[model samples]
Target: MIDHSIDRDPARPDVGHGHFRVDEKRWDSTFFGRQIGSLSWTELPADRKAGRTELGRIAELSDAAGYSLVECHVGMTDFTLISLLEDIGFRVVDSRVRFLTRWTLADVPVTTPLDGAIRWAVPSDRDRIVELTHEGFTDNDKFCSRFKNPDYFSAGDTRRYFEAWIDSTAFEADAASAVLEIDNEVRGYFIYQVRGEYEELPVVKGILTAVAPNSRGANGHLAMQAFLYHRLGLSDWFLDNTTQLTNTPVIRNHIRSSKRLDEIVLTLYRRPAA
Candidate 1:
């Protein structure tokens, strides 16, 4: 048996390491009527056996919980563990790339709409926002596959996931949910949260942003970006952005605006209840 001391490394910051968990809520298992488990971890015990044992335990527990599949997120730097996971039957599904931007007053664009438009979302906007979210994420990076495998994932599942997000974001006090209105109609929306601290500097994170497919050319996206940057820039906050690797449009836009890629994550999956 491997010593548990690996988790208490004195040389590494307590928060630097990652953890593995089964997030049932995020996957909409109850709504979808399917048990899906998410496995994530940052550091592995030096004892490979222990790491494998832990993963095996997770798989077993997921099976017991009636999970049909287990999704695992592995960072690029953790190749050793990746190889181990692959050997144990997990196949890569999708990948995520994390980008970071240090927003300041200087980074704010002068072209952003200065009008007193762009307001926080209200209860009346929930249905439309959910619809927009469902449409925007149908081809999301996490499950972006040309195979069109409904058994693995479906548009209905995507809608359910966003429904949960909208429901939860509405109740989060630290969250900022905003929508762009043109001619008194919502065209785009964004969800952000004030999270994390580095050297006491606050971090503003964008959880989701989407423009109605039909409204793409109306500058709704730019308006949303400009509004958030200007708002966060006022506090000299650092910005964290994450997107799936297949989201070329969003990635290209961020890069064009000077966002730097910080990390790449690979999400692998094992099916048939482990």
Candidate 2:
């Protein structure tokens, strides 16, 4: 049997660092109103048996520690770890794909109402952005939103969580953040953080993009994107963005803009067997 060890973080007792560990997700727990945990360390453990042993131990320990669920996000290419997680009863919740868009700005003019073009997000746009985030994310009708799983999260919890998330980061961008205004109303917004630079050009990572439901079907999405591109200065930054695997509009736009596929992430969750 592989020896199980725990790491003392003073603030957290469930954290460990050997083959695997279950790190308490205090933020998520507070957000969802429960004790939640996550599998720490993304890399696959060297010994498969040891990893399996620890996975089981962590599940039991997490349950005893009051965590109602444990979540893990791993690269889709890591089949070995996926198998181990599946073997230990973790279930897939969401798959997200990151695309590398050398051109983070859209090429097509894709015109709409002149008022609907994207502009830099301001402090006043916080509430609208939060509302849009809530509306855009609450729907699990077509695609499975990661946090909307009935087994783990409540009906309105996911939307509120995202609303709070975007609210927190609404105007707090590392490099640049922009919004789409239509008829003097904020229709959508995006946040770009500079990860660093690539040979003088900034490496910008698009962290969040959301469009209001009422703004759909009018080429507004592309229009806002193109405006963002122009606003940031065309073809001058290394950019990458991620979207849910089932997000067809973004996937199509990424392909049309010549953005190559970068990576795929699979999110899984585990809980005590009832």
Best by lDDT: 2
Where model 1 places Cα greater than 4 Å from the true spot, the runs are: 1-67, 110-117, 139-149, 153-155, 231-234
lDDT by residue (1-274, candidate 2, tens digit) is 1111223357766455466678666567666677777786756668899888877777677777776888888886676788888887899999888876554344445455444666778878888877776666666367567677787777777677667666555555454677788888888877766667765777777767777767776666656556566666546677777788888887898889678888899889888767
Instruction: Itemize residue pairs with steric clashes in candidate 1.
Output: 20-40
Quote each prediction's TM-score: 0.73, 0.79
Candidate 1, run of 10 with poorest lDDT: 1-10
Give the worst 10-residue stretch by lDDT in candidate 2. Answer: 1-10
lDDT of 2: 0.71
Model 1, span 31-99: residue lDDT tens: 567665566665577788777777766666656656676667778778678877876678887778888
